[model samples]
Target: MPRGTDHRPRYEQVAAELREQILTGDLAPGAQLPSTAQLMARFDAANATIQRALKSLKDEGFLNSRVGKGVYVRNQPPLVIDTGAYLPPDGSFSYELIDVETLSPPADVAAALGLADGEEAVRRRRILLHDGQPLELSASYYPADIAANTALSKPGKIKGGAPKVLAGLGLPQRAFVDRVSARPPTREEVEMLDLPVRTPVIRQLRVVLSDDDRPVEASVLVKGAHLYELQFRRLVSDPEANDV
Candidate 1:
C-alpha cells in the first residue's frame, strides 16, 4: 500500500500512514510519536498540515495528548474481535442475557438471514462485560425453522453459546460476513453499554453462514469506539480471488 496511490488530502494521507502503522503494530500502543519537525521532514508536510493530521487521530481515539508530554498512542489496547473470535471470551469475561424471545427481526436482519417478510425470528439480546465493566451490546436473530425446539427459542441462557447450539442442530456456522459502521448509540444501547457520554459507537452487522453460504444467524453489535478494534485478512494475493 503506497501513500502516493491515495488521492486524499496530504494531511489525511499522513494520518492514514500513521494510522496504518498503529494498526499494524509498527507503532505500538503508548509509543511516543516522532517530533513534529521530524514528522514534517518525513511527510514533507507543513506545520498546520501535520497538526491537522495529529488532531484527526486524536478525534478518532487513536492518540492522546499529555500537554507537557508529546502525543502518545492510546495506552489501552482495543479489544480485538476477528472472524473466529467474534463471540465474547467465555472464561475471561462474562455477560448478561437481557432478553430472549421469538419476535420479528429488523428488516436488515431478516434480509441477512433469508427470512421472508413477516417471518418471525428468535431474538436473543445480551451485554458483554470485561473486568466487570459493560463492553458491548449484541442482539442476535435466528429463523424460526432453524431455532425451533432449540435452546435459542427458549427464554433462558444457552449453555456453550448459540454457535454450539446451532452446531448441534446440524447447521454449524462456517463463515461470517461483517459490516462495520459508526453511529450514535440508542438510549437502550447507551444504558446497556454503560457509556458515560453520547459518543458515536462502532456497530457491526454480522451474518453467520453455514454450508453453501446459507445464513443461519444474523447479529447486530454495538460497542464503544474506544473499546474495540476489528481485524481482517485476505487470502488472495492478487486483485482477483479465484475462490474468494
Candidate 2:
C-alpha cells in the first residue's frame, strides 16, 4: 500500500495491523516489537508513519520502551484512580496496612521529598479495599527524623495503619496534593494484582504536608483497570471575608 494512502489515516491502519498481531498471539506478552527501520521496511512506509503508529499503541497502553531497549508489549492493565471531589465532610477511606519496612530511600523518592541522597526512611505498604475488592496498593514513606520517634518507626506498628497512628502522635490533619498519571503496570505488579496482561494501571502520587508546611508523608497509589475515576473542582476564595 502507498504511504498515507488509506482513506482512514495511515497511522490508524498501521496501529490496526499491530493490534491484530497482538490479538492473534503473534506478539505475545513481553514480546519486543520490530525496530523502526525494520517496521518501515515491513510496512513499506516512511519513518514518520511507523512512529505515529507506535505512538498510538504506546498511548493506548499496549507498548513500553526504555532508553536503550526497544519497545515491548506491556503485560498489564491501566489503573483507574478515583480522584473524588473534595467535599467538606469527606473522610479518609478504609485501608489495611499489610507490611512495613525501614530502608534507604530510592533516588527518585528522595528527590521527590527533597531529602538528602541515601537517607533512611520508613516504608509502609498497605492494601486498600472498598467493599471487599482490592482497590489500590498504597506505599507511603516518612522521613526518618519524624517517623523514627513515633510508633510507625517500629516493625509491627504498620498493622495499626497510618491515620490512627498519626493522630496518636499529635500531628493534626492538614492539606494534601495528589498528582495523577496513567501507564501499564510492571511485570511483578501484573502478577501481584491478578490483572490481565493488557490492562493499564492508574498511578496517584499523594504528598501530605503538615500544617507547618513540612513534608510528613508521601504515598504512591496504584489502582486496577477501570475500577475508579478522578474528579477535581475549583474553589474560589472569598475576598470580603474577615481580615482580622
Candidate 3:
C-alpha cells in the first residue's frame, strides 16, 4: 500500500492493520499468519519492516512464532466483567493497599461527592488482584465526615469491604451509577498493571448513593483495555431501558 498521507511509520502502519485483523477475527486465533515474504509483498514493505511489524504483535501477545514454523494468532479471550455486581473479594481475590489519605478530590469526584472547594475526602487506594495478578487499580473516596475515623481511612484492608463499613455507619449504599470511558493508560497504571506498549485502559467512575440520594462513595476503577471488557445486561421490554 502507498504511504500516501498517513504519517505513521511503515512498520507501525503494517502492524496496525494486522492488529485489526486479529481483533476482528479476520485472522482467527490459532490461524497461522502469512509467510514473512508474502507479508512483505502484501504491505509493500521491506523484509525488516515486516519482521518489525510481526515482532510488535508478538510483544503485545497477539501472535506467537514457532521455532521452525511461523507466527499464529494467540488464543486470548478478553475477560468479561459484570458491571452490576458489587461483591467482596473471595478466596481467589485479594487487595493490596496502596495508600489511605485525606486529600482534595479531583474536580469530578468533588462534584460527585458534593464537596465544597478545599473540602477534603478520605481516599483509599488499592490494587485488586485475581490469582495474585493485578486486575484493577481502584481509588475510592468518601466524604471526610463519614469516613474520617473509620476503617475506610486506614491503610489495612477492610474485612468485608467499604460497603460493609459504610452500612455499619448507617450510610448503606442503595444505588450507584457508573460512567465508563476508554483512553490511554497513565504511566503509573502501565507500571502497576504491567500493560504492554500501545495498550489502552478502561476507566470507570462510580458514585454510590445512600438514602435521600446522598452520595456516600465515589470511586475510580482502572483496568487494562486488552485484558477486560465490560458486560451490561438489560431487559428489552423494561421501561427503564432508556435510563440504561
Please identify which of the two predictions, 2 or 3, would achieve the higher TM-score against the true structure: 3
Candidate 3 per-residue lDDT, tens place, 110-130, comes to 999999999999999989887
Report lDDT (Cα) of residue 182, candidate 2: 90
Looking at candidate 3, what is the lDDT of residue 57? 84
Total backbone collisions for each predicted model = 0, 14, 0
Could you tell which candidate, 2 or 3, scores higher by lDDT? 3
- TM-score of structure candidate 2: 0.56
Writing each residue's lDDT as its tens digit, candidate 1 over 147-201 gives 9888998877888889899899898989999888999988988777766443569
Which residue runs of candidate 2 sit more than 4 Å off their true CA positions? 1-94, 155-161, 167-170, 238-244
- Candidate 1 has an lDDT of 0.85
lDDT of 2 at 217: 77
Tens digits of per-residue lDDT for model 2, 6-106: 58678778888997786556898688998999999998989999998888788656788877988997774333233542211323445666777888776
